[model samples]
Target: MDYERARAEQKLQLQELENIRLEAYKNSRLYKEKVTAVHDKNIKRREFQPGDLIFLYNSRMRLMPGKLRSRWDGLYRIERVEPYGVFHLSHPSSSELIKVNGIRLKLFHSEKMARNQELEIFLLEDPTTADD
Candidate 1:
């Protein structure tokens, strides 16, 4: 009779452990869903239209030597914008075109500024010191 009571208590403990494990799984799922929602809210949507000037990001920059090497290539004209973040690009000087993911590109907003335009420099005057 003692053996039977001990077996019953063991079974109850096993049942409680299983319930705790299931509750932990449920809590983990809820945490992941909340985290995903927060992450999606901060993501910026990239939009590009055809004929827009944009720079292509070089993915192979780590293999090159320079520490300050620029990762972005010269502005390439968008030939076509496809569904699912695919962009057709072409260099202004070349007729050849290449298709690349939209994530690897950024818009160049230099249309308002002329290529040969010069910037005006302003000089700051030093404060006058009174000599004794």
Candidate 2:
């Protein structure tokens, strides 16, 4: 009788351990699924096309000496779209096209274009006319 009781207790303990392990596995799978769903939703799949003008972040663009330091430069024209969102850009200063990642580029809006145009016009205007 004593031996039978000991064996029964051992079986119950083993069953409990198995249950705990299964629960842990289920929880881990649930967490992974939730994380994957959120990541998929946040991914930007839209690709930039040829002829689209974008602003290259200063940190990403190669700097040249004696040039005005700008946080955002190059109304870069997209020459080609490569795999994995990489782009071929025609940088005005470089005059040579270069490949860059899409994350480093931001699409330019019409409002920004208007503002830059106004600034260019003001800079080019005669100073004598302003005093008149």
Candidate 3:
């Protein structure tokens, strides 16, 4: 019967549509994972040593009314560098030590700049051309 044939065709079409949808979902998940891997690869690795000075990021600074205010606070010295992004910091004025995430801190390079200022500069003179 023609009705039976048409019903079989309709069932086949529905099955094909479901297969296509599943394939699409698989592709989307793969793409998302690839993007995440690339992002993690691009992140810079931070290393800290004991006695190094660093600035801590103040998460609450954004809530303040002043737009010009710096989000980074503290010139704390690194007392210890623990595994897995944990840093122990101590302030010169404070006796207590604080443990913070390494992601929230950046090394203060002011000491490097001071050492760079002592470098001697040489002025080079070009040889005079006789054709002039």
- The lDDT for every candidate, in the order shown, is 0.89, 0.81, 0.90
Each candidate's TM vs. the true structure?
0.82, 0.65, 0.76
Q: Per-residue lDDT tens digits of candidate 1, residues 1-132? A: 999999999999999999999999999999999999999999998798999899999989968877656789978999998899998999988999999999999998876555648867564454578972
TM-score of 2: 0.65
lDDT (Cα) of model 1: 0.89
| lDDT (tens digit, per residue) of candidate 3 on 1-132 | 999999999999999999999999999999999999999999887798999899999999878866556788879999988889899999999999999999999989977779786877664455589996
Which pairs in model 3 have colliding backbones? none
Tell me the tens digit of each residue's lDDT in model 2 across 1-132. Answer: 999999999999999999999999999999999999999999977567899889888773355543444567768999998888789999767778888888888887756777775553323332487558
Segments in model 3 whose C-alpha atoms lie over 4 Å from true places: 116-132
Backbone clash pairs for candidate 2 read none
Stretch of 10 with least lDDT, candidate 1: 119-128
Ranking by TM-score: 1, 3, 2
At residue 93, candidate 2 shows an lDDT of 72
Clash pairs (backbone) in predicted model 1: none
Question: How much is 37 displaced in model 2, in angstroms?
Answer: 1.3
User: Judged by lDDT, which candidate is best?
Assistant: 3
Predictions: Cα RMSD each: 8.4, 7.4, 11.2
lDDT computed for candidate 2: 0.81
